[model samples]
Target chain A: MAPPHDEVADSRDRAWGLRVGTEADGTEARQPVMADVARLAGVSHQTVSRVLNGAPHVRPGTRARVLAAIRELDYRPNSAARALVTRRSQTLGVVSFDSTLYGPASTLDGIERAARTAGYFVSVAGLRSLDSRSVQEAVDRLRDQGVEGVAVIAPQISAVGALAKLSSAVPVVAVGAGSRSRLPMVSFDNRAGAEVATRHLLDLGHRTVHHLAGPVGWTEGRDRQDGWRQALEAGGARVSRIGGGDWSARSGYEAGRRIAHDPEVTAVFCANDHMALGLLRALREAGRAVPGEISVVGFDDIPEAAYFTPPLTTVRQDFGELGRRALELLLEEIEGVDRPRHPVRISPETVLRRSTGPARRT
Target chain B: MAPPHDEVADSRDRAWGLRVGTEADGTEARQPVMADVARLAGVSHQTVSRVLNGAPHVRPGTRARVLAAIRELDYRPNSAARALVTRRSQTLGVVSFDSTLYGPASTLDGIERAARTAGYFVSVAGLRSLDSRSVQEAVDRLRDQGVEGVAVIAPQISAVGALAKLSSAVPVVAVGAGSRSRLPMVSFDNRAGAEVATRHLLDLGHRTVHHLAGPVGWTEGRDRQDGWRQALEAGGARVSRIGGGDWSARSGYEAGRRIAHDPEVTAVFCANDHMALGLLRALREAGRAVPGEISVVGFDDIPEAAYFTPPLTTVRQDFGELGRRALELLLEEIEGVDRPRHPVRISPETVLRRSTGPARRT
Candidate 1:
């Protein structure tokens, strides 16, 4: 339930009137209306309206002039009046879980940026848990607010399942929920990224690579682990699955401790860069030189990855691109476009640095 | 200008009716209204109204029963209707710059959590630049959408200055802009945190400490540096001001490269843990062991800090608590509470880890 907004009604109402007029004395100067823009642009009011609505009939030169005048006057069409005419809020709701994590956080940032560019406001609801009830409640709350569409950053399996079970009146898109989802989804090539990282170590002459996975329930983690296992088996190399970490450096360090002590361990592939930092530290402390005694690779070439002791070789996920694409897809659905439902997979690229090298002669 | 709300007027109207009834086929079902809640609690409609309005006349047991009925029915009062009566939006706008960094990201997550708990929706607008034009435009956009109040997470000097010059109609709170601003503000004690981190090394018997600061314009960076300088001056120790980093591991590595060659440098305090991670790596590459030869401490005890090679002894700022406090203060002001105009400062604490140790015998 949204809190009442009337607490500051008096002050807010006064400010609303002042917003249109620029006079310091609170004179009624009024913001530039559509007619003012049309007059300044030397175009018909209908043409200016056409430009604003992105209609195809307006000439390019006239559109340019109208846009220039709008920018010059800092014209913002009154959203309330527009909402009344169109009966659309032009706002999108986003449901995100574990929003502090790099991937989710980056995705959320991307969504906000893209939404703004598309002339839409973003309302975000961060979930503390992945329970089905919580997901339903969040959607219901957003629905009550009358958003045009929704984007759920559902990385966890449970979250995706809950989303699939729920029905929304507006268009909905899920980010990072894998390709098998029933709803429109956008995801990075998590499986292929892990496969490339694993294969990089294999090509470096490491017989097999040890895996340090992210926490269970995350689709990305599971997909990456599957890819690693697939690559190892395809190469006929022995596969060693280490206990998974909770996508934290501490968990990576703890996992690295056990791997460092094993003489047979020659190479490792962590799910993310933070864990790779821990792995590097563990190997260094154990007196095992990186690349000389062991090779390491990580996923998600986070900003700090390049500065890791020996620099890190990892896969990069373009979260911003994902967000942009997701918004575009959601908008298409909201605008009543008859596009087919299919998952949009953004490709991931491997970033080679000093972290991975040819296995030394035993 | 808020968008029109007439597009789904028919469906929404029907939903409003169903909210009070429990008919099958899901079409007849509606959110429980106050009347329904009253009936379920075996109380008069006026009594339910009194409970909802917090009139203070209801007995404790009756209040509990009303609340329980409300909860069981998942009743949410129609915010739009309420807004019509009270002229409130029931939404809070957040203006944040650099929404991807850990501190800012964590703070955003905290704001969302706190807003949800307070039964308010959070609308976020991310600024691409700290220029006053951009800041003003973002605020105008949110304002056009009718947000009740705003929380501006302005970390840079330009951003703080921009926020200070702007006149907002809604209650506004700036976070992390230092304590000198005229607007209500909430901030973590960056200076004290840095001072404690620097003094920890000084107390460990280090002759002097090198400082790796964040990029220029950020108040956190400047405040932390000031604290480090103050601590060194108080200890009568030489302060080596190495060129600052942009709060990134790459910049930290570059700064560390210069510091590692100087044999006189015995301790270093990084403005952030990310920079500290890079510093540790640079020292390791330069063959100068941490603590064994030189000690290092960092601010912002990030989750990965403890997982650094020897773990990091750093200062921790409660970003979530800061967000919560900022929202609380903004709400008070919005509710017309006559609170004093001053910044609310949250203290920082040092987490003892293995990053710092006694100075090595020269």
Candidate 2:
């Protein structure tokens, strides 16, 4: 059952440890193995294992001796050898859109924090797209590196077949991909957020709300747009043809230019804070004062949202909670706990600020 | 040298593959090993290996049969077996400050793109602090997981002793850490960027620019403060006491509130975009018009800068380039390439927009 080439790797591993030890400790020419610690402490290998694992059977004197031996030798148990013993790499992988957009970036930071708290190493694969081929490749690459589970933070859940195939390979939890798929997912209610924004504007006495939507392809954009439309229709208001942007401030500004001169448009709900900032600028340039001449609402209360000239009223998504819950679900799946299949959805809360107000007298 | 427990893992690997194959392929209940493909194709194991590795010297017909056999049996090479053969994990690690801040997040995205292009998996370790003890712990963990190299994107370059110790364990490249350390670093010229911002305001006829600086502990903040002071001295303008923020818009707003009513402060340069944004809000609240009564400039042209009410004038750092160059340096270190010892420093550019104008005659 032995692989012929393993001898080469084994020799290389020994040489690597020795070389590192020589340079690291200066005086020490070789790394001390567990056996060395066992010998120094006059303990059996099982006793050392019990001490290392924090198992209860080791006497206080024996534990103290083993710890002293370990400190004296500065021995670090080899990761590969640990994997060989436990069949766990203690590593998780994240595949995300390779963009520095605020939402994905914050979620990633959150996931990393959660993983560290849960005692796992997190690996990441940045994909240019969430197409089937890209996802397939990214997952395969992570799996090849021995990741125990994966968290995918991209929005293109339309690539359902590929994701379905991928989950069979490893435990996976989706974040922000919407709850469309049967896979375990932790998502923010983008639709609910948009609805709340639209309703708030509507309650401010606006006849109708113009929607500045995110790019059409994003699931978040689609859900939010749906919510906006639903709220408008429910309020008996006319639905203006939606203006779209790629979630950039510039694009929002451009969309604002078109809406600013339209005397009939008194209210707007932007899909994200950056675009809302741009829209506000365009309105300002057109001599339209926020919440006076026009009322504006945005989504995702990014750190800069409150600093906008008039201060933005936007949806607050707890990305930290989303990440923590995603990790919880991923770990559960990895441990093979048979829980009922229900996607975890967090409802976003609306933050009221100066940007939204009563419509001006016509 | 054989571990006695390996038989259990080996059997589990086989069973795991079969279960996944049954679930993934439906029709195929057993996952095909390389030997199965070889047997079906009537080729030696070496021939199958050659085909899998894309090595030359197999006849076209033999290659076709091997491909057909691979397709028929749905073979996926076992990762552990592959590790035994090559002894390379093809993974690189990144240790970063666990923050959703613009700089670190963007740089991390850049590193991930570069790593993927270079055909490597990127593992991440997010530390709450870049202190000496935390770094040593993180690097040790990554080393245990068999990362070929690490890119650290945090600033406490003062942790020189611990970082110096870490290099012996693995190849590492530091990003944003000051050039003071002997370790190779990819850093933005924070001082130069600050100088450009201050000089731009000074050139606009502002006698001196009040600085709204980031927190003092950050290397970027300290360097920026130095550059601001140096620029004022060179221009023969009296340097005022600097205001400080925590790199958040809210902090900037508070600093702005203190300065908005000051007749002596006609111009202000912030250390980062978010702080500048806060400053703008505070000025607006105080009825001070941008470029009319006061002028403002900021560093780090975050995506929303251009959409500001008066589009922000700022210094732009190319975080992508910073990440890419850091990865290049790390790869060089991993490959043991002999190179000059000087660190790589990228100069940021000043992006002028509507925010800055000649100071109003006092």
Candidate 3:
């Protein structure tokens, strides 16, 4: 019953985003001592350590509260700090990108939330640049923070390339880096999502669907473009010239101004929701009726997509699942659980809305 | 004279949200050493140490590159790590709320970018909740990361109240946590922004402007409401019963639906851009024309604001400067500079666009 990528959008709308991590990777420097947890949990240091070590005779309720205190304080002890099994730092590190684009920010938030729910302090190092040197430095930074493992929310090309060669003492997982990464990673099927969106437009009687791509050098953009191209080829429709942007609403608007001019461009699939929003404005300004004259599909069912002039039809990327899976995988590796090599791909769901509809006769 | 908060938005558009911090509050756990900095900078450990200690033996160019490597790797040494002057962690800790709201997120990005540019690595601890216990725990988590200083990006009432009572060994600066907070905080004057927004509508020949406010219990929400009421009172206009939401578009749409039923309502001011967007949609659905009949204005001129069907007229909060000022304040405190007590209040500017016009004859 396990799906590589999620098959359908589930009803579990838990407001997924960043909560945080596991393991007590306490460094020689002072950190969340057992006393801190004891004070917070209204217990003694000895009792907290006893719970941490999973010793017999500790009550379940006491253990749960102690764990809660430990989690709240982010007191994960590094095993090197002590000779006993009692040592552990319930902390996980995440390497994040600079931008707050809907996809990556949500993914980071998801991982952090899952990690925190599982009793760990999530430490994030947002990279100024994704060069190999910078990525390596970030890993080093996380190591300094005493993280037991790491999750790189890297969807850019440079970051993924750097990730492939990264060597760390603890486990590391890549989220949405790309399909070709050598390290363990989890990603939603952006390609599949694009294909579905394109097919929906094609099925609406449009001869072909135009693609508004993200900027060059993005893995998500590439995957989406590939999917759109593949779907067009599969449908025996002509692959048209692709429009591009740096993935900003303004860029999308500028690109949209041009895309709106083409009378033949009756159906368009945008790379993400923000861009689609701009495209909608452009179409409206040009006096082209949406769905009536042009059918549009967008990827990433961002919260704002539903409130667009005509509610947008978009591919909903469940970052909640993606983040949880990445953290779980990292935890498995940290805790000596076997980590599967193949990347986990969550398939996006194409949501039906007024933006996409049957193409009107020219 | 320097403004307590920024008086105007600057021309510098760095696409700021979260880049991150400085100082290597490295723990006893094995971390980024001078050797690591040397490796990254392609310099020797001696040179790195010399640069760190402010020694005159190293070349200016060499010192610059070594610091770059130190920053790139987040390899700031905690003072305890070395007895000599050769210790410092170029890292700053930020305690952030979990939501990706436009205001807070932008402020965070600005801080991170400023931190990184100034040769520091930023560490963020996102809170799952804003209760006092949760806020305290977040602060404790940052302490565990070995940050020399902290910035609490707290906006909620609970978080602000907790922050007022907070005591820490490291310097702490509050960002957007409300003006009433006792802590050494920096905030944008949402009250001033709201007053200007309301005043703009009243000047446009409207009797009074109805308000769509953020959920209760938020300091920003409270401040905005206060400003709106004050502006309405000043204009001798009837202050209608306020509308509210949990700062989401859906809530705005719901509120808009109700507001749209009333023909007496000629103009409305929304708390944030996202909610305004929903209001626009609902207005259209109800056959109310933006500017043509009902003038609408919003706060937070988010990137998508301009792309809205009738490019939204709204207030723009310059988070870049706010964040930099907060970080700078924290850094000043960290470096033993005299601390200032008054909270920094940044005033937002209203950008005129197509969303607002004079009230109809009716």
Candidate 2 lDDT, A233-331, residue by residue in tens: 999999985579988999999998898898888899999998999999999999998889899999999988988978999999988888889999988
Ranking by DockQ: 2, 1, 3
Q: After superposition, how far is residue A304 of candidate 1 from its true place, in Å?
A: 1.0
TM-score of each: 0.82, 0.90, 0.80
* Model 1 chain B lDDT-worst window of ten: B1-10
Q: What tens-digit string does per-residue lDDT give for candidate 3 at A105-125? A: 677778877886787767677
- Point to the candidate with the largest DockQ: 2
Candidate 1 Cα outliers beyond 4 Å, as residue runs = A1-85, B1-82
Task: State which candidate has the highest TM-score.
Answer: 2
For residues B241-285, what per-residue lDDT tens digits would candidate 2 score against the true structure? Answer: 557998899999999899999989899989899899999999989
Higher-ranked by DockQ: 1 or 2: 2
Higher-lDDT candidate of 1 and 3: 1
Model 3 scores what on Cα lDDT? 0.77
lDDT digits (tens) for residues A29-76 of candidate 1: 555678889999998877888898899978888899999999987676
Error of 3 at B125 (Å): 2.5
Instruction: Locate the minimum summed-lDDT window of 10 residues in model 3 chain A.
Output: A13-22
The TM-score, computed over Cα atoms with residue i paired to residue i, of candidate 1 is: 0.82
